[model samples]
Target chain A: MAETSRDAKRARTAQLILEAAREEFATRGFDGATIRGIAAAAAVDPSLVIQHYGSKAALFAVAVQLPSNNADVAADHLLEVLAVRLGELPPETRALVRSMLTVPEAEASMRQFLDERVENLAGSFDGDDAKLQALLAVSGILGLTITQHFLKLRAFDDVSSESLLEAAGGWLAPAKGDT
Target chain B: MAETSRDAKRARTAQLILEAAREEFATRGFDGATIRGIAAAAAVDPSLVIQHYGSKAALFAVAVQLPSNNADVAADHLLEVLAVRLGELPPETRALVRSMLTVPEAEASMRQFLDERVENLAGSFDGDDAKLQALLAVSGILGLTITQHFLKLRAFDDVSSESLLEAAGGWLAPAKGDT
Candidate 1:
């Protein structure tokens, strides 16, 4: 009985640490954020954070793991992905995207994630430039997601994701001439 | 003669500080970067940095100003902008983009810049969704810049900006059914 309660308490503390870590990472990026800062924000001792998460890199990995979408990157799948991403971005994903360029760990994670997506998407198109086309399409969607979700451009506030996708149909359709 | 040499020396010092400021801002972003760090990087006193640039906010503004494009957002103009942006993102612009979401000042600057461009592009399109279409197109280009330049995705290294632009034709063209 005591062990069960203790396990529950540990899980709760870990969850608390994760929430604080996400906020710190999202605000400061990986390089600027510290375990101590996260611990303080979580209202726990610094050592307790290390105890719960192992290391800063490990914590970041666990914190920023985006929910994987297993579907292939078809037109419908792309729209679905954009719809979710264009709305409020998950704070963890925001932390990863925000820090991807400046921080090595974040960059590695993002590169791995994006490479897989680009590969999956490139296979959908035909031609010598298929990979590049896939990349351009994916990159464009990423930009829209950043504008709406991260940058919060006021001009986009009135526009629906459906409307944006409709406007994007040309890009999402098979590369011009391939069809 | 002494006064003229002093003026030259002062200008040199200011230029050095600006270069250092750009590197610091690029690496750490706006919120993470410190005036002290910029000074140290420039081999100047913190007070000297303040004397030269006034404040961090003022320094950032001076450092990150992109070379203004005077042309309208026509297809040719859009391609020209993308060519420059995709080739190599200026460190200052990278700093602004990297920090835009997390830092209020960067966000304000980026919002102002993008809003003006969206307005200009929207006027060229014909329909209720013109502004939204403009925003999506601009956002996609921004995303491409981030992927190729900032993120340094290895997959994009082989792809020329010309090819990428060609793949992006559908995006840069006026929205379908608008013509």
Candidate 2:
């Protein structure tokens, strides 16, 4: 089929709205953000946002997806990624995590997302407690994320990612039984 | 020197207001809660709340203190305490954590609180990196707390605290040289 300029224009507008929604949600949080606010940021009509995404919750869902296979990264690879993850989180993920606790809808989405990650990680291990072990691993990562991204703890500023990885290796290794 | 009827009534009213404040903050978060609402919940006039607690921030500070020397419970004993910590968080602590990220004042209070804990925990360790190690250890504990307390991940419900304490022991042991 031939490419249509109209379809391309629609895709561009959707992308613009998504980026705007990410910033609005991240700065103001879920309850604080609104359809009109997101639309204003995107320079689009509020109706256009509704036409494209349907509702505020629906737009948020699309805005905050984790990269595919985020959980599949082997345990050792986590340290390398942790170095990057320790830095600023993407606006979308930040929006989701920031709002997850206070907002019921955000909490539901985050829970489902975390459960899927745990299930995937568990598939690589053997034992009845595999899921539990995986859950703990995920929890550790979540803790670090919250501390660095949300809490902005100063203690972390004094240490290098390599040092952190070394310190964390002691326990993280036992959880996986591998490098 | 004798206790007066006037003093007793004042203490009781203060306690009642504190309890209501805890519940209001926990359910509505820092930004969502209001002095009027807290007073209504406590069955008191708003003036009394202000008279006792100068500001909302001041009220929150007293309400959400972690137990004295919470971090002083040596690494090995953490498991025993972990059993208790894993249960539902107190409404006061929950209220603080619920608001920590989005609320600037809450985040500052939480950061200072965590730094003191890391410093206290580091006092027991050796080496220049002791503080960093303590920070990671605390991060792990914070992760577990957030997962169990706020996220309410179902995986935790399936596993007994005994089992969790055991599984976590593998990594936690290495974080601290002792059991």
Candidate 3:
């Protein structure tokens, strides 16, 4: 009974650490962030972080949460959700956009995430140009996200999420000529 | 005669510094890099960095030149150049592609440049959907670039520069319909 309770507590503690780590890493970046900082943000003991995640790098890998077995599904869902959320953002979201554009920590985390995606795709695809194709797809999605969400360029920044998603879905889908 | 030579030397020194700064920032990122490091790489005295560029931030602004002016012309020319370059890269260029995609410094610098371009466009185009449209265009171009150059995705990575340019050029041109 005691062991069961202890395991539950450990799981709960790990969850808290993860949430805190995501926010910290998103704000401070991998190099700038510390284990102690993440623990403090979670209101847990610093040792708990090391005990739970092994190291700062390991903690980061977990916090970033790279796309998993369902890459295509996740990518599609991300595009759809982003298109909607971006369209619905209150006027106040300008501040959020501004933060995303100017913040180094946010930029770093984003880069790390995209790089991993590209690397994973490169490994799975087999062809002379397989790696480049993977890179392009990753770059394209990232480029779109940055331009629409952060820079808020004209036409793109003002359109409904539905419209953006429609366009992105078309581009992302396999075209007849592609094969 | 001596004054003219001194002026020429100063100009040469400034150019060298700027070039060195670009490479360093592209490789090490803004936070990890230092003025002394840039100077050493440039083979100039550290004080000359301050004398020529004033500060690290100032140097970065100048070194990482954004595509702010003549968007249409720059976009067109960039596409052409990239297409040609893509066709010319040796098989070994795969490694370069990997580096660009995986490196945080490269990723941040690329995003920073794109964000600036999108923001500049947003200021010019005003309407309900103008911002969104501008953002989409920027993202599209960036996405295409990453796809073709880094990921080496099929069809795109293997095609000749002119062929790729032809496809991209059409995309960049004003859309005729919703499709």
Candidate 4:
């Protein structure tokens, strides 16, 4: 019973530290963030952070959750959902999008994610033309995400995701000149 | 004659400062960059940076040249030109593209450039749609640059820019459902 209680306590402490670390890393970047700052934010001693995560770099690797395969599926459905959700998002969400574009940690995560996608998924293409098509498809989705969500350019700021997706679906279709 | 020599000397100093600043800002970011470090890289006294640019921020704003309009053409043409230029670039140009995308100073320059495009040139579309189109265009360009050049995702690393441009032009054209 005592062991169970201790494990639970450890879990809660780790969760708190992870959340704090994510916010700090996102805002200050990998180079700028300090483990001590993360500990203070998590309401724990610096030693506790080392105990929980092993090291600052390890904590960061854990904090920025790399989007899983689930995220890829989510990305495929992004335009449809984004259009619906745009009207409902609070101002903070917009700010978050802006930060993701401007911040180094967010940018690095995005690059890493895309690199993985290209390596793993782009191989499905059969021929040179087919590969080019696959590349364009990926480029279109990535472009839409960065422009509409991250850069928050005035052009896309007010446009619904539905309209954009409808256009993308047509553009990304598997036909010559369809784009 | 002495004024010409002074002017020439100042030009060389400013160029050195700018080059050093770009390298520093690219690696360390704006907040992390210091005039002292820039001076050290340029082999000049710290006071020279202040004398030339007034402040670190001011120096940065100047060193990072934001994209600008030539005042003689439409945004569409600008996009086309960008597409062509990007397509024409050699594979070795990936380093430059990566620097543009990942560097904090370069990202800011890109934002400023896009903001100007939306404000000055994205006037063709009606109401909010203009902004949406502008955002989409920028997103498309950025996505292509990152995927093809910076990240160099497999097949894209070796593909010629002309082929990529041909693909993009098709994607950027008006949708059948739209018009």
lDDT of 2 at A99: 87
Q: What is the C-alpha lDDT profile of model 2 across B108-174, one tens digit per residue?
A: 7777766766667677777777777677766777677767777778777677887666656544544
- What digit string (tens of lDDT, one per residue) describes model 3 on residues B144-163? 65445543344443446654
Off-target runs (Cα >4 Å) in candidate 2 are A1-3, A67-86, A127-129, A166-179, B1-4, B54-58, B67-86, B127-129, B167-179
Off by over 4 Å in 3: A70-75, A78-139, A174-179, B70-75, B78-134, B147-163, B174-179
Regions of candidate 1 where Cα sits further than 4 Å from its true position? A27-46, A67-86, A168-170, A175-179, B1-5, B31-46, B67-86, B175-179
A39-103 in candidate 4: lDDT tens per residue?
A: 99999999999999999867866766554444344324434332322444222223223333335
Chain A accuracy as TM-score for every candidate? 0.77, 0.79, 0.62, 0.65
Poorest stretch of ten by lDDT in candidate 3 chain B: B91-100
Q: Which candidate number has the best DockQ?
A: 2
Determine which window of 10 residues in candidate 1 chain B has minimal summed lDDT: B78-87
TM-score of each: 0.82, 0.82, 0.68, 0.74
lDDT for model 1 comes to 0.75
Listed models, DockQ each? 0.56, 0.57, 0.24, 0.40
